[model samples]
Target: MNPLAKLDQLDLEPAAKTEVAALIQSLIEQAERDAKIIQAKDAVINAKDVKIAALTHELAYYKRIRFSTKSEALAPLQRDVFEETWNTDISAIEAEVEQLQDDQPCATVARPKRLRAGRQPLPPHLPRIEHRHEPEFCTCGQCGKDLVKIGEDISEQLDVEPAKFFVHRHIRPQYACRACETITAAPIPPAVIDGGMAAVGLLTWMLIGKFLDHLPLYRLEQIAARDGVSLSRSTLADWVGRLGVALQPLAERLAWHLRQRSSLHADETPVPQLDPGNGKTKKAYLWAYRSNDLQPGPKIIIFDYQAGRSGRHAQQFLQDWQGHLVVDDYGGYKALFAATRAHPETQYILESCIELACWAHARRKFFDLFQTSQSPVAQEALNRIAELYTNEAEGRDMTADARQRLRIEKSLPVLTNLHDWLQQTRLTAAPNSATAKAIDYSLKRWAALMRYAETGDLPIDNNPVENSIRPIALGKKNWLFAGSERAGQRAAVIQTLLGTAKLNGLDPAAWLKDTLEKLPAWPNNRIDELLPFAAPD
Candidate 1:
């Protein structure tokens, strides 16, 4: 039936055996050709990878020159300056130490004592009692004036709503049919997820604190304990995990929205995820994508986390995305945009990260300048860069088309001059010089890195995404890593919702709760209504 199978089933006599062997050899050659074709396709992928790596290498900032643009009056701070800043009342400490034999206080500072721990519970089910008689007294000693109660203004303060486990009361009241018609007294509520314990509000609160606010679950547990509530960190982790599963559809839609933009900014930061089977740990990647489309549409930001920085991972994550993607020349992205079906798409454009190759980084080549702060060369670079940024800042609010045109008309000449001067400066500059290396990097990646200026849709700097990534970077110091792969994705989903809410200028808790209740019954065809940019009623 099959060509290869036919080779095994060949019928021939003794004389014809040699001819049959020749036929088999031809079939083998055909198989070899197919293998070569596969390898050729792989080669194309490799070529793209090489190009991306080359670009990424050019953009990566490795060496930095610590330039001091400050004047000599503000020299590098002494260690004591830090000591004085960190410790309270330095002069008081010195004077007190000098006067004291062992330990003595001059005076005690009166401050409200802060409660550290322990909470007293209220008595159960106490009913309110009110006296009919007026209790207020007049300011006068005698009956000079009598204060009369005209109207009672009842004010209520909710001091405590006690930490309690929540239960969704679903009342399914049945009705009997009398005249060929049935009636029911209760209506069912459409929950975000069926049989899910986590309410959307509580779930979003956990995420906002964990990701957006960089509060670790353990710390959250501590905070809860202080509030007379005790929730386990493990339980919190599971809550986030389940939240991720629920949000996957939205995350995919977000990625799709990001790709629809004219361009996107992407970056990756490392996250440590635990490995259960091996009793060891492994690396995880938090890949972030941000895009603001000004074509009469709302801005969208999406964050994703993958287990590894593999080329295949990028390909799969961005499977639905197509557009000009602005990213540092990461090889992972190169492989993705190469062999994947999204490859060769006319809408998909790759713009290089040129802002990273700025004069600020190049100026860092001179460490001595930082030590002197008064160094003229370092000051010259700083002054030049300051002017460029100031000029560009003026165009930030303009339309993408206008921004592009302005960059070409106004900013192009400054970049051209800076590029030429840096090349000339690097030729004779010291090889080991920080200034020289920075200049060299800027020169090499000048074209690709500066590509942002070519279009108004792209930012002059990759700051929007970088700013978003900073919270996660800071968070790693406290919470550290995900306990597992699914945990990392959970973090990503929470971060996405929080970040999107911030973009929409809505409270994260409110949005998450609304979304959860709305998402399940949400018409799959009308998911856009849930997007941050959707029109309000």
Candidate 2:
């Protein structure tokens, strides 16, 4: 400033003054260029710092996954510790960024906690056995006066009586006509398993025990021995086999009814099948198909057993059905959907069955990546998916039209944004990383995943069928494997009826007992009356 003032005071010639002004302008431009260089360097440094933080988080995530409890739930104290650490780290990063940008730190807001519910009371329907206790001394010690009767203290302790076995004597009185010499006796009521000592009650108990309770035949035989009733495993097996055959018609009816629906959920689980020839167990599939929740009918689940996990199994079972099929990203269903599209003229494709992909499957990919890598990209994808699920929850009980409208209004924009972000982010992601794979999987099934929003009748996932198949998964651990192909098929039949009965809120044992008693003389045309939902309350 002093040099410039001195120049002004110098009263120099015009050319000298112009030269000095040019020099000063050049210096100012150089300073501005230097400042720009520093800003660019800082930007690169900040980017690197973000990458380092993400990688550090990812490393810690992997370590926790490897060493921590498998349960996703955290104890209150553990959660507090985690939140404290996360907040401290986040605050530090925020402070650094604020310092770099010369900005104030934002205030932190804690999330509101949800209120816990009180203990629920026991059901009122159970029979009560009251016990009365009389005090020896009715007089109060301090007052020396008789205590007045006010109220009785009530407490309940549940008790159980061990299973009681009984026998039913079917008395058949025969009378001979004296003159005609003709003999006549009252006919015995028909049993589910004809000519077998096992009554309908015993058959129902065995079926319920094996299929619903997952008790193996040998275990049930042992249980029977404890009750002083010696039932051989072979006898139990015979009963089960006959019951399976008797219920075959009912299971077929259920399957037929399920296929008539406009939409269905399908899934499969592996069952080990004993191969006598190889002296080893072979893997077989138990396919479960469930009726749509929104469909106007009683919910039904049918399990089909197949020797292999082939698309043909599903195709054959679902033959002549044309509607939406919700399933996971199993390749076996691709052929079925393709056939539906190819043969629009065929009866199977008259309505052109649409393949609705499960959002759960898509979310699983990113979830797995997040669990393994804790990548910000994966987390962002998970957050977006969670929003879609939130929207689904809001529309869960809405009418079909209202639900579709809600999805179109709220979900469509999210999907569009997610699609764009995935496209842009994929370019920068490493080709071989878990995050990249998740992105690719979602983008590949983008059309199918997004299709759920188009119709309210379609569910977001195939969880109904998946849940239906869960019993088999649990049973497999105890039973190990099916004895043969026929045994596997029998299991499928029993499971189908039991599963459907449970879905309809009917007690499996009671339903089976009633159905077994009635199905023998029940009219063929009125078979639907025997369905679990149609049973008397």
lDDT of 1 by residue, 1-537 (tens): 455456557676756877777787898899999999989866755654454444333323211111222332232233334444533343343334333312323212222223245544444454445445545555445766766557885433235553354555666878878988877667556665566566666666777778777888888898778877678988887776666787787777877776666566677878888888888778889888877443445656777889888767656766655555655545666654454342366855543212232233333443355455455555655555566676578886787788788888877777777767667777877786756655565566676546666666655545567667777876887887688776787778778867877776777776777887788788889987786564565
Candidate 2 residue-wise lDDT at 363: 82
The numbered model that scores best in lDDT is: 2
Q: Give residue 270's error in model 2 in angstroms.
A: 1.2
Query: Which stretches in model 2 have alpha-carbon errors above 4 Å?
Result: 1-118, 138-145, 175-184, 340-351, 534-537
In the range 50-118, model 2's lDDT, one tens digit per residue, is 654554466456445444643233533455456677656655644444443333122122222323476
Candidate 1, after superposition: displacement of residue 346 in Å? 10
- Model 2: C-alpha RMSD to truth? 22.5
Error of 2 at 147 (Å): 3.5
How many Å off is the CA of 455 in candidate 2? 1.5
